[model samples]
Target chain A: MVNVAGPADKIEPSFLEVSTNKYKGILSWLLTVDHKRIGILYLFSMMTFFSVAVVFGFLIRLELIAPGRTIMGPQMYNQLFTLHGIIMIFLFIIPGLPAVFGNFFLPIMIGAKDVIFPRINLFSWYLFITGGLIAVISTMLPGGSADTGWTFYVPYSVRTTTNVIPALAAAFILGFSSILTGLNFVTTVHRMRAPGMTWFKMPLFVWGLYATAWVQILATPIIGITLALVIVERFLGVGIFDPALGGDPVLYQHLFWIYSHPAVYIMIIPAMGIVSEIIPVFARRTIFGYRFIAFSSLAIALFGSLVWAHHMFTAGMSDTAQFVFSFLTYAVSIPSAIKIFNWVSTMYKGSIQLDPPFLYVLSFIFQFSIGGFTGLMLGALSVNIHLQDTSFVVAHFHYVMFGGTGFGIFAAMHYWFPKMFGRMYNKKVATWAWAITTIGYNALYFPMFIMGYLGMPRRYYDYLPEFQPYHVASTIGSWILILGLIIMFTNLIVGMRRGKKAPANPWGGATLEWTTQSPPILENFHTIPTIEKGPYDYSQFEIPAAKEAQ
Target chain B: MFRSASNFSDNVDAVFLYIAGLSLIVLIGITVTMVYFVIRYSRKRNPVPKNIEGNLTLEILWTAIPFLLFMSMFYFGWVGYKDMRAIPADAIDIRVTARMWQWSFEYPNGVKTDTLYVPVSKAVKVDLKSMDVSHAFYVPAFRIKKDVYANKNNNLWFRSDKVGRYDIACAEYCGLNHSKMYSAVQVMEQKDFDAWFAEVSKKAGVQPTLVLQLKK
Candidate 1:
């Protein structure tokens, strides 16, 4: 074990000595145990995977523009959509905000030197990369990538000629990485809180992460087993889900949704946490109902686990079972609505700042509400019978995932970019990106709801000519969305070098993460900060002398 | 491109309209409140806003109201799902097998066809299974979709309340020809369905005859 340095050890040797040169520092960044360094590592890796997956999404949309295989053949189209689902869900969305930003900020937010297990934090990033590599390499294999979709439902998973096993194995491995990260975060939050930092005193972002960690720890193992069973069925001819062997395929749906239903919460809770942070900061007041909002996260997590079977209503479950699941699904929406109302109430008559982060947060409020409402419709067994596996289901999820978690990520990126890189992005460009993305996202997904209601099914490589208009509209919107994303990322990356240097607390927020210097030192905090009040109390700080100097 | 069909289609459409209306009302209410509050209480207008921490009464009201709204929706959904699930006793039975790139339907009279044929107004119960991958049997006109799995059987029944042609497509992604895997549903009058069945059976006679002889 490495020796633990004392606080008095001011000249402690660096973990990896780097030349003062920039490129060498970049190399050191690739292999480091420092939590801050590892967080940036996850950020870049997830962004790369996200970019590739977005390109895949574009290809799928382009193919559907005129209905009958416009851009690619049926087989290629199948691969493209499947790849997009697997990459986006597993590599990007699942770990997108939590693993990257959470790892970077969680310790700092809670006033800790580092995560409770720094080595494990670093290892999670490597495991994520390795899993991503396995998935990427499967695409290059002989028959091309697995086309069983991300769900990899059995029988087809066992029988497909594509490399289904490797891709699923990659997913299973990634699930472990997620579980470990969850376990680490849970322990860090529980055991490593600074002196006098009570659970209630911890920032809402911490509360959000805390709830998500519970979900990760409890729910990921189920998917791990479910994916493992698929692999076993594929390779060993285990008839667990193969009808020829007298196994029940419905069991696979049960097992898969058991984990996946909560996985949706895993994606959104941290985002809610991000919103909680931003809402109060911009409103310049204490959050309206801190306890209710914090508890709502926990409530969503607990209730989210029970609603998985709603996904199985049309898969031939008994009517009684369907009714039960349908009710539970609707019940879960209550907590989500609570969080939304709480956000709006938090901003009620409060001093509101319309910065880039707040803009995206407000966008999330509107878009996620639409998504949640549509979700309630799907939860109704009657409506689901008409809408399941249709473009409506597609629209509902994109609204939640993209509009909810995706916007949350973008907002957090803008909110934290200053702290992470010590630079400011061009506000004008950032605003343009947000506007284009919001409009383009709606344009792409809104028509899906209409087409779904109009009876257009999803996952088809070809469709009747009558459905062409909606597909064309969606495709055009996708192009615009891509353009917005390109501008957003380009501006951020370029701004790293050219933008003005940021102060320690540019937003004047009370979270302990803002206590450190921008682009924090390896130890993070020079002196560990102790929490005194709730995270949203901006009135506590003295007016900056720098403003007078300016 | 759209045409009025029968009572069943009308019922389905009514359900859609009801849901769409409810969703729109909620959307409008939320949007109006959100926009009004933002503009009326802007920081420029009132820089030092109220610092209200928590309101128990408002929280309870929000929670209770949504629960009530959701219950109403659930009640309608329950009735609709019950209607969707209750198949008639005299319904025709058909076996449906979904593979990677094709759908095959087998009728009770021992006739197998690539496309589905059924009598209009007679409920058809499809016992679906998959040969290789999981595929969803989706008939948008019937407003029904069910996942067909390799080792498991899932059955869904629907009556085509009209005599017309409808498109059948796989709703789940399997592989390669997933998009190309299409079929047609020919809903005909009872007499017409029998005639078509007889004609197909006549063409399939010799093999049946040979099997019977071999058994004898």
Candidate 2:
């Protein structure tokens, strides 16, 4: 019903110069309903939040560099650490790839001009920015930002005179934004793919986003309700979670993890999609087990939701409940492991090119493997009882969230840099940056595992003398990691402003996105394309006519 | 190597080693295979790629093997965990209450102490309670930790095998001074524990109803 392919003026230069809009300056960007423009706006907002969260993280590390207070008191330290988690998890990582890259590329990859609901798309971005601003304003309030640590566990959250509700409210509002984005994506995928493109022919990345969107829609409401309950308990004296008013606190943990655990899959599935996209492009081979890989994404999403209670192993539930959750946790790992096996196999006996993106993928596989296997360790009931709330758990989280998702982000940025903007970055510098960050990231997190096994707990402002050495090593690693990030991002900014032009299909990618110009025209395709093969069918690409790409 | 100082420690460690050791093997194997494949199939070396769709046999083999492997791991973990969770009939009872930044331990004789004192070679069940926010009672040497919940009956049991002082910590993130919420568990011989228990009984107050119900 929608005329997505646009008018016959196919000679339009780019989306940036949509002469029909005619409203020249900042108004065009602010009021634009274009999906590409909306995606760029999301990128800018995430960059700001991510930069602040990184600084907050670095400062937390600096404080923990010694046995006692290094720079600030415990009150200030608690606020800084809590802010970092709140901003990083809520403001940055959770909404990251799905909002920015997914919005930008999903329509283009599926031969759609725009998402089904463009106004809602822009509204979600506004919601995200508003939620982020509330968090910043809460920090400047009378008592300071939330010191209840992002979980905002009961009693402390109720008793702490700090700005708890505003921060909790911020997370609540952000959930609305995520849910809307998921709705837009699911509808667009269902209604907007080109005529000849069947569901199986869609790129693996779209499948990844599809699975993630369902999670966002399904899992986000529980957290919203949970946050609302917390506020109710704090102000109106309704003790749903606070034990002070004859309430059950463990129930709060159950409800919180039910959403938060699946929220982790929402953070991860898109990253896995990015990995799938990168491996096939660099390997120059049709993906092995395409159906299996696609279904596994769905499997990860489904199984991921069921394993939330594994986190509550130490919470003293019945033996039957613990056993069932632990068993389900083991089952969940199967789909994730299947993905890893298929990724490695995709590389076997194929033409491999070690570009910056591929290099990041290599390290992603290495580091994410550690993250996955250690996750199994945490899932084991006996082992988890010992490791819960320890630095080992902290290390495992970083290995997955930071190591897996963070590296997946880097890989996607490099892999799609030429397509998003119309330029190529300095390859040599990019490679160097990857090596440094990979080394620094591992160095920063790996030591925490050993220290945790040695009985060092997480979320401590200060620790005993025995932990000083590991903390010192971790702080030094943070410096290297930050340095690498700076160089990588600076190279990208310089490239976007002034660099060599990028070709349409730089990596010989077989996706529909590579068929269009870099920084695609306003109405994506010159004409709607009819799909005839799977997204990764490299055999069709071997023809000489296809070799003459721009 | 971890100090196997509690009866459950060795069992927990065995499960940990079985999984961790197995993980080391699998991780290294996957990494090595991946690196090998990358180098062996570089564009310069293999200009043309084989259009091999895939082998169904190989996919089935890998999936089935991993499925069976984890089931074994689940069994190993569950068996080790079952014993620690079930408190023996003669297990000694200690009531532990956790607040924002401190720990309190109450013995059967209505004896209160900052440090947890128990007889070695005896199963001790700790009845956990939180006076404020959620906290976790953790003893790494024993490889045993359980959350202390408010308005809930949560408990964990362990038998100390070594006669020495070990650490007790609040593993959950409770507010400021959480790191300072540290105490020691003195695992003493039977004679030493009996002597201290007799002395504490002489100077003790009335026993709480919770401990009295446990005695019944």
Candidate 3:
């Protein structure tokens, strides 16, 4: 076994230490099977797409600042929003936490050396990048890119003059990448846990990934097949969803959402896992209702699959069908509510640390509640009949996806930055970033609800004069949100160069990752840790005096 | 807020308020509890955390209470919707066909118009159909929306209580000119609607451009 008790500077070459590796230069990372390197690859690539898509998102807000074209024409506006949706939903958010943090930490948290299939893990990354590159190239194709929005609703998708086939092809390729990642994660979790790490004793993050992995495997294939069918319809001239071709368009929505709705859980569950991972460590207490939180993840995965029809409420369905889906939607809300309750109680009467990560968690609780509660209004059929296609729906989704899942990624980033990089960011600036983003996030989306309630449709290239005010406020919020993003990324980037070196277990976390060196050595541990305590049993946690001195 | 223009608008509003109010209460409660706990149990204040695993009773109570609350919401929502989906036998019928960027309303009396003309204080059922892609007929004042799908005869109805023009937006995203798909519902006096219809039929062979500006 590698030495574990070495001095700070004497620690062995970490997975990040490529200068001393025999592979040398670019080959080191590009050809590496190290899980940490793969995780870093996913992290860097995801951030790039996230940065590009957020700019596209800002352009959408800018165009909506006033009626009539602000910068570009309606055609460009349609394409921008469509690209933003595709890149953000598929390339960035859905695979976000599970792919990035889960790749890096899942094995470490469960006290394993690497994923069960390291080469396949690397292959998944290549496929992910290949899918991304194809999307990038699709825009440069013969007739420009797909402008059917991200949903790629048929007839429009089939008949659109723009180049939709490549975007569809890109999505088809990406689904394989998603499925393989899920397969790898499931096998790793199933087979690679340390001998003493019982299923119940694993970190909540691991449980979250486990549940999400099932969704990625089970639900992703449906979308893969559906996208493939759309491709076949396009090139082969076999009609599946186009009405004129003797196919039904509504059937396409059913197939898309069957996977896409459960895909929502794929995006958010791991975020919940991130919140679960952070709340206890920062609160300095055992996570409340560990079993409940773990089971709720599975419950969300289960109920999440059945409620896909909620999205089809106004998409022409029978009342009985609507009633069934609506009730199931309400049913899914229970598990989400239980998890929220557990998170709040986990902070109750505990030694709460007001770190940037915990601050983000507090905002997560507030913002995600707004997202979830609005989901209830949308779930109620009568209300959804009015709100389904309005800005209210847009606001609700952003509050959940961007506010909940996006902020969860930020929280996980800040919480684990030290451990991941072996360096620390400026806490004061990080705190400022969190506060500004929270305020800016609420300001950005809260007005959409008002406009939506008063009847403003989403995806409008030019809106009426009455909506100008809400649009103005939303545009201003986007500016503030971008400012926060700039500051946050800059601080983290700069800190990586000049920041203080981090110690193992910087947050006094009780997981096996905390037992290893910061930025962790290749093979992860000196020896596979035999766990005697659960990940969040913080009574066993002891903070280093240096952490208090900070 | 804009004026309510339909018979069941207030019913939908009441349900919205009930759910929105409860949501506000729970949202505030969640925030307050979270903030209070964080401050009350700050590391400086309580250096040693209470290593409490959990309380089962509290968990069960919250779970059950929220479940009941949502059930009540579901009931109220269904009640509000019953009036919307039930079309009266004596209701006036109009076929609404939406294309890429416009809505056309066709009357049973063989008159068709780009703008909807319905008599106030009478139940009007709209048989929604799409010529091409999917589009939702959304009139916020009346709180009515139903998807108009190609080759589908989905329908929705409303009874106007106010004689005024109301905005109708194609809520679903159709192609290029989706935003310009703005139409208005002209809820007129019964006599006014009859006069308009009669004039349209009388001038059926004449230049129709001037008559389109009747509301211009």
Candidate 4:
């Protein structure tokens, strides 16, 4: 047996033990079942994945700098874009917010020591890593990675020489991981709330996660089945979607969109939750129409599922299907509109603090509105006929994904930086990063809208001479956008080592997370605290001068 | 314009216009209300606005109104879909096969080509298939798109109003040259279509032009 020394007999090491909890050492972190430690592990892993995917994005932008292929050939370009999409959506955006920040804060917000299923929570992270590794391995295969886009529709996926099976299998595995995390959160929220923390009294972030979790649990299974069918058709010659085999390819689209349309909500709702938390704190007021905002999250989730068929409008769907989908698509916009209304109303007449997080929240509103409106335009059957598969669709999703969800991630990172690292990031660097990103984002996406209006289609490796200028402008703006991201990450990483120690309540928010020390201990709470008041109770904070002085 | 293409296009256009108009109205109304509220309740303008919790009536009204609006939209959408589903009896059948970087169109006369050809002002059905990978056949002018899947056949149809050349492209990403996989649609008058078919048949060494004999 290996010799182990007692605590008192141990020689004096350079570092202090930093003792307090039952867990300690590197192995404690690597083998940790603690939700908070697992969350931190997820956070770091996602950041690394995000950085890798960003490189792919920049490479894509680089290739599109001119009308024709530049650094890479057409085939390589296809692989790059497909891998970029897969990595960004599956590896980053889908799991990025929920798995990292959600796991860390959800339990603490609900006044629980841990999530309802802590072991499953850790298992989800490992599953995520396993899925990510499979995707990475596909890239190393003999024929190279999957050239099929993230959707991986059948027939072509059946025939493609590339490693479609491994790539698709990766997505399928990731979907399972996503479903488990969603189930975990839903159960935790339902069964783990502290005393007096009723539904209405709980924080809005929890509500947002609650809605998102429902979508994850209900919709992800369909995609799982859909992808599995595609893989089976590829290997077994089953011909479920093969036309020559008398199968219906349109049916594949129907099933794929059925899940994908709601998956967009899975991407956005948690970010909305992040925004909800940041907004009330900065505004220093109760959220306007709290019930409306909370219910709207549910409304968006439910309606979001119904609108998936809208993606199939141009896919030779029955006119009746197109009309119904178009109509339902437009209807879904109402709840999203309600959400925007409530966010703006929450800011009305409030003492607003224009911090980095608040700035991102403000930008999210403007960009998300534009994104939502454009989605309405696409939902209209007539406009969709004109804009389908065009640069307009590209611009619209970027506004929602990059502008909406991406900005929300930035806001969350800024807001939670102190809590995660126990150090404050440089505000000056953050402001500059925000300014550059805002300007760069618009410059990159806005021109695509113009090009799309001029009738330039999307996914083109080469374009007509007329569309060249817009392509040039978009490419240049992407570089600027990449620069902003670089600056932001650099600032945060450097600050972790050299930045000043942050106070517990750096933003003066009344949330339970704010009440704890910066980077709380392993158990999260020193003692489980009970909630007796609503989340936005500023009135309780007002004390007499004599009491305030103490 | 309503009769030029298929009835499906007209219905699609109608639903689009209605939704666009409604969305515009909602946008303008929301913006106006927000601006009005901000200026009216500005901190400088009003030292202390009422700390009202919520208006139950307003909440009920907004919720009920959107519900009604959604129901109406859904009704029209369902009706429009019914109209689109009934394929015309006289629809001309064409076979489409999509590959990684190419699209092949096969006509009833056993004529195969990379580009699609159709008579103007006629309902044409395309039975789409894929040789490898999934690809979406999107014709913006026709307002139709369908996925061409490997081993599976999906069909879509449309009628062209104008006799001209239009671009046909693969909407979904397939392989490295997905962007390069593009074809063209040549819409011609019936007489011109017959003559072109006859000439192509003669070139292929067929004794009688299948298309011309069928017309006769």
- Number of the top-ranking candidate, with TM-score as the measure: 3
Q: Give the Cα lDDT of each candidate.
A: 0.82, 0.86, 0.87, 0.76
Candidate 4: residue A246 Cα off by (Å): 5.2
Candidate 1 interface RMS: 1.7
DockQ for candidate 4, C-alpha atoms? 0.30
- Taking the candidates in order, what DockQ does each have? 0.59, 0.70, 0.68, 0.30
lDDT of 2 by residue, A429-464 (tens): 899999999988988999899889878988988887
Instruction: Write down the TM-score of every candidate.
Output: 0.93, 0.96, 0.97, 0.86
Scanning candidate 4 chain A in windows of ten residues, the lowest lDDT window is A1-10
Q: Of 3 and 4, which scores higher on lDDT?
A: 3
**lDDT by residue (tens digit), candidate 1, A215-264:** 99999999999899888888888767777788777788899999999999
- Kindly report which residue stretches of model 4 are placed more than 4 angstroms away from their true locations once superposed: A1-25, A233-247, A318-320, A453-455, A542-550, B1-52, B60-100, B104-114, B117-134, B149-163, B187-198, B201-216
Which ranges in model 1 have alpha carbons more than 4 Å from their true place?
A: A1-24, A541-550, B1-8, B194-216
What is candidate 4's lDDT per residue for A1-550, written digit by digit as tens?
Answer: 0011123222222111232235678766666777777777888888887888888878877888787758888767777778888888888888878888889889878777789998898888889999999999999999899876677765566677899999988989999999999999999999999776889988888998899999999999998998998888888888688666777767887888888889899889888888888876765667777788788889889999998887766566666577667777867777777777777776666655567787888778778877887786676555566567789888999899878998988999989887777778888788899888888888889899777755577767777667778888998898888889988989999878888766656776777777666666566665677787777765544321111111
Instruction: Give the poorly placed runs of model 2, Cα more than 4 Å off.
Output: A1-12, A19-22, A542-550, B205-216
Alpha-carbon deviation at A397 in model 3, angstroms: 0.7
How far residue A192's Cα lies from its native spot in candidate 4, in Å, is 1.9
Off by over 4 Å in 3: A1-10, A18-22, A544-549, B205-216
Per-residue accuracy of model 3 over A1-550 as CA lDDT, tens digit each: 1123345456677778843246976888898888888888999999999999999999999999999989999888888899999999989998789879999999998888889998888899998899899899989888888889999998788888898888988888888888888999999999999877899998889998999999999999899999989889888889798887878878898999999999899999999999999998888888999999999999999999999988877777888888888888999999999999999999887888788888888888888999999999998888888888889999999999999999999999998898899888899999999988988888899999999989898899998898899999999999999999999999999878888888776787777787788788888887776777777876655663336527
Query: Residue-wise lDDT of candidate 4 within B54-119, one digit each (tens)?
Result: 567766667677657656655665566454445677888888998767999877666777888888
